[model samples]
Target: MQIRVADKAIDLSEGATCASVLAEGLSKKQFKNTVAAKCGETIFDLDRLIPAGCDELVPVFADTPEGLDVIRHSAAHIMAEAVKTLFPEAQVTIGPAIENGFYYDFAYKRPFTPEDLEAIEAEMERIVGRDHSFTCRLVSKDEALSLFKDMGEEYKLEIINDLGQDNYSLYSQGNFTDLCRGPHIPRTGMLKAVKLLSVAGAYWRGDEKNPMLQRIYGTAFANPKDLKTYLHRIEEAKKRDHRRLGTQLDLFSFSEEAGPGMVIWHPKGMLVRTILEDFERKEHLKRGYQIVQGPLILKRELWERSGHYENYRENMYFTEIDEQAYGIKPMNCLSHMLIYRSNIRSYRDLPQRYFELGMVHRHEKSGVLHGLSRVRAFTQDDAHIICRPDQLLEEITGVIQFVKDVAGLFGFDFELELSTRPEKSIGSDDDWERATTALTDALESVGLPYEINAGDGAFYGPKIDIKLRDALDRKWQCATVQCDFTLPERFDLHYIGQDGERHRPVMLHRVILGSVERFLGILIEHTGGAFPTWLAPTQVRILTVTDAQNDFAEACHKTLQGVGLRVEADTRNEKLGYKVREAQVEKIPYMLVIGDKEVADNVVNVRLRTGENLGTKTIDEVVDMIRNDCLEPFKRGGMSYSFF
Candidate 1:
């Protein structure tokens, strides 16, 4: 037999296999100890004889994401095999690859312990060294049910009964046989680098009403170096966990007494939030947006009218006041629409832009509560644009530019996603079509690349979601622009045209910094709590080397504060090194040290967070440096250098 590997063809005698092909010609050391093989697009075990009609054979090295996933999934099956081997009473269910790794669920009598994980992992290594071939077979439903029934695998029988197809696939290795749909790596030996991460109990189908199954979580990599890197990254992420950082920095906290998802912003956190709101308010005013205020609670009828009751009731909180049902506002649009309808207007009043830093509350599941990321209460930088049909393009373009400028100021390169009407929605087909087309055209006109998230839009209209990538390569969706056709029709909003005839107005609901709290969370993580000079809560800290120099430090603070800098005087009698270390820990942008030499010369010792030493510069010179570099937000600390 003959076969082509990557670039050349090789001939082999009868009874030769892929493993032997590599061993004989390539390198005995590489072939006899390899993990998996890919024949064309299909991946299989190296021990499998090259099928008669096969064309090409390529090695799967386990370094790529697809290769790693296949390896991890195979490791999961290996874990299942080890479990069944150790505890014959355990029944295996579905197992699949997730974000970082994979997990397998099993119906068992006792919970798995750390000792059990160790034992299972050891067994997995032995099974891999055995190098058993993982063979796949398609069997009819009746055959699968009878086979598992005879083997006392009741769970497999149940799964076969519920499968939609009459025929299903199963994979077998040694005495271990399990139901699966696999593009699995060649064999157990391919799972070279593996680790058992953790164990937990999961509901059979993620429903509490179903039976509880113990899930074993694990991860695998193609190479040892890659595995080491992943473990280090995991450790770093844990150290930088927002929940822990929030407490250590005294920024915010969630009370177990009050609730799980509710955040109680402390004084420091509130100060940061106030600064953000002020910045947003000034930006909105400059963009021709009229700031508006709305109530915190509204009658249930209003939500019913807005179609929120039909679409979002499950995630809403209802209350009673004076024998009438009311709901805490989950959004600001209903009030904004009501404000628009307060009076009829002519075409001259078209394109009214309303802005609101509105606070909203939504009910989040207890298990999904995360620090700032998933919260029950937050404020939205919400706006509603009501414009004539002819003004839609310009209005949308302006909004997109507004979002770009804001994100650019914050040093984020954002990716855009345009989501179209969902299957369950309210509006005429023509209206939906026109509104979606207008949004796509507007984005194209601006020459922005975007992805289409089909059927993921709001109930009222289509929208474009912007996800900004942070410093660590993590993406966060912080801005959105929605084209709402249903809201205007439902609200019966209209304006009189030049011909004295009623004309329908298009409504656009948008937000920059989708929620202030969520955006703040991302900011903290993005900078690792060391904010840029302009956005930093405390821009400069003046530390006295000793009590003798307190007066000089205070003078420096006063001068900086007078010039509108966020300055603080650290006159607590701490050592110079202690003060510097404290400032670094707080992630302050700049620090100045004062002593006899510095006071006599009328100069201050300056240090930057980037480890740059701007040695003993005059106070006037230092102030001028900060003023020029930190004021223009888009240019602040040089954020725009890489954006283009």
Candidate 2:
């Protein structure tokens, strides 16, 4: 058989493997780093024989993304082996490579502890040192079932029965074997830089009804340097975790009594939320959007008409009211459409944008909820634009620009992704194509780069998602613009055309800050709880040096508050240094020091959150300085703000 390796053509024996061909073409170093081979899009294990019609072979290097996935997947199998060796009664279930790491679930007698993880990691190192070859073989379903059944692996038996396949592939290294469709690394020795991260409890198959299993998380890299870099990032992420900072900064809390996935906002947290809401309202109004409100729950029949009952009922909360079924909304679009249809006329009202800071509820699984990021009850900065089909592209572009402006204000760099239709959707093929084309065209028209995300769009239509990259290079999905022709058609929404005929108006469902709670959580982590001057919940804290200065501190606080600044006074009977330290820990943007000297001069000393101390300034000067600081972010975002 003849095959192509890079630019060279080589003739190989009939039973030659991919590794044999690569060994002929690549240098020793390159061949050692090659974990797998790719033929077009299909990846192949090194020991797999080259198919008759195969044309080209591309080496998948260990450092590449695809190669890393293979390495991580093989590492997971090794970890499973280590676990089974250490704990003979433990049964391993599915383990796969996730983003940045891998996890394996084991149905053990009890939850694994931190000490167990250390032992398992040590066993993994020994396995790597043994240099066991990963060999693959095909087996009939009956044979695989008998093999696992005899070994007392009930989970594997259940998986095999559920798969209902004629044959299965099994990968074995040393005495341990696992059911997998794998193109793993050639040997266990290739897994040199690996670390066990943590352990958590998970229900089998992510169903609450199933038995709980112990899941061990871990990661692997091509070399020690890369692994060290990744570990450092992990440590940094711990420091920036929003849930910890939220408590330290006294921002918010969650209580088991109030139920999980519900945020109980503290005063300071609520103040921050209010500031964000105010900014949203002003920005929307300037962009020709009308503020609106809708009822929290509506008739179930209404949801059915809008396709939510059929497609999204699982995530919705439902109840009975007056012998009628009612569903608490998971989205704000239905009511916005009703408002548009209340009374409408000509094309002049075609591009009506309705905005709301609407609160919504979703039946999120308890296991998935994390701080404010994933919550059952939260508010969305949602909007709906009812526009003529001719105005669709312009409307999408406008929303894109709006997202850009908002991201700029927060000093975020973002990326765009155009998501296409999913498997279960409401729209027709033509409508889906048109909606996707409109989003793609809008992105191209603005000369912004974007990648296509396949089959991840909303059930209603295709969308453009904007993911913000924060200070630590973590991405958050904050904004989205979805184009929909299905919802308007479903509701029979129309506008009068110049031709004296009614035409179906297209709808756009969008959110600048997708979930207010989630956005706040991201913001907390992005800024490390030290918000910018304009967005800080408490802009200034007045600190008095002694009892004699308490009255002056009160006056200073009043003056600052009178100027529309969020201010508080630290008049407690504590030392000046202690109060200053407390204020700093709270991440207050500014601190005003009032002492005997400041009182005599009728001035205040300004200390910034960055630890910069400006000399004493008069009250009027201080007010002007803060006001300018408040306007700076708006100016950068190409917007304006007012205190009154």
Candidate 3:
């Protein structure tokens, strides 16, 4: 029998199974470069042989993301096996791979303690040392159900019953069996370095109404050293958690009475937010974006027209007024579309960009909300660019550039990802193809590398998502540029072309700092609450050694404030050391100490938050240093600086 595996043809014996073919290919180094394998249209374990007569086989590699996911999935199963061996009664519900790692849900009576995790880790090491082979078996649905039932595993039986097939598959290792559609690793040893990270309470199948399950989150790596490094990074990330730093630096707070996931920005937090929003507003204006405002609540019909009702209704809030239904807007595109249709447009007005610091409400599940990263109500720096078919590529290019400029200002290095059509989307096939091509061409023109995320785009369009690598090497998606060929059509948006014919305007939906609150949260974590000199809420604090220098400190503070710096004088009845420590704790970028000698010399002693102390320097010189620091990413007023 002949088969094609990743565009290569191979011959196999009539009785060969999928596992045998995979083993043969790997021995010949045909699959060394591959991450996973597929038989016909079904994804299969690499250890499985191609059923002889199968005409197609595709090998998947870890370089592609799906291949990595397969590896993570296998790691999850390994972790589960370790858990069950150690606890014995820890009923495993389901374990699946997520974005960065994998999580296993267990119907345990109590949370797994820290000591329990250590025991599980030791057991997992033992299991991996044994290198038990994972044997796959295909059984009749009745047989599979009977097997799980006899074992008193209700969850496994429930899952098997829901599977709509007469013959189902199971993978067994020793006494452990799992009901899975799997492309798992061949042996336990394949998952070499493993760590069970944490435990949390999660509802079964993510339904809040279902039984709560204890979830164990973990990650795995091909190399043991890589696994160690990943664990170190996780520790580093926790130390820099924004919610913790927010309080340590007196930045923000969340009131229980106010509700979870809502942030109340303190004076310092608000100050930083103001600077960020002001910067964004100016950039938008310079880029020919006309600012617009819309009501928070609109008639429900508007959302229905934008396809949000059908696709995103579950995540939205709805209300009824005067016997008419309304919804608090979850996005600004629908409102902007209505604004655009309020008047007629011509070819000369082809690309109209409307910007808004729009506030949107989303009904986020409480369990999923974490600090400001996931929130219920937030503001988006949203913009919609309406253009003709000929202008689609150019509009996308401009939006990408806009995103880059804004991100660079905050010292974030970002990568691009193209999200394609989702399973349940609104547009026609042709529109999806056209919009995807436009986004691809735009990214290519910029010479930026991108990865495609199949079935992850918005309902109305395909999008180019920008993921920023944070200070701790973690990635966060913060910018989006989506091309919508559907919304304009739904709203009947048009522009008179040069040929005097009506044509639908292609809508480009874009956002920089996707949500102000979330971006601020990232910023807090990235900087560890010590923002750059320019963006710091309080750029400098003037500390005086004694009453004799109080007047001088106040004058110096006024001088710095006059130079457009956020400065305050510490004139309280406190020792100089106390004031200096206070300033450092507050994360003020710079601290200026005024002593009698310095006051008389017209100089100031500068102390950095990182404990760098400089001898007294002239006030002008000190101001010059700050100006240079402020110009790090952009040359403002002919001043510049670099990351070094």
Lowest lDDT 10-mer window, candidate 3?
635-644
Best of the candidates, TM-score: 2
lDDT of 3 by residue, 1-644 (tens): 57765545667776666555665555556455454677665677766666545687666665456766777887777777888888778788898888668889999888888788888778878877788877788999999889878877888887877766899988876567888778776677766667888889898877777889999888776557877888888888888899999888778889899998788899888888888888778878888999998999999998887888999999999999999999999999988988899989999987899999999999888778888899998999999999888988778888888777777777788999999999999989999999999999999999999999999999889999999888887799999999999989999999888899988889999998999999988988888788988888888888888889888887787788888878888888798889888888778889988888898899999999988998889878988888878875577323233321
Tell me, what's the RMSD of every candidate?
5.6, 1.8, 3.6
Which segments of model 3 are wrong by more than 4 Å? 1-46, 51-71, 573-578, 636-644
Instruction: Give the true-structure RMSD of model 1.
Output: 5.6
Off by over 4 Å in 2: 1-3, 7-13
Misplaced by over 4 Å in model 1 are 1-76, 79-94, 103-124, 130-182, 192-225, 636-644
Q: Rank order by lDDT, top first? A: 2, 1, 3
- Cα lDDT tens digits for candidate 1, 379-438: 999999999988999999998998888888878889999999899889999989989998
Error of 1 at 477 (Å): 2.2
RMSD of 2: 1.8
**lDDT (0-100) at residue 370 of candidate 2?**
94
Cα misplacement distance, residue 461 of candidate 1 (Å):
2.4
Supply the TM-score for candidate 1: 0.82
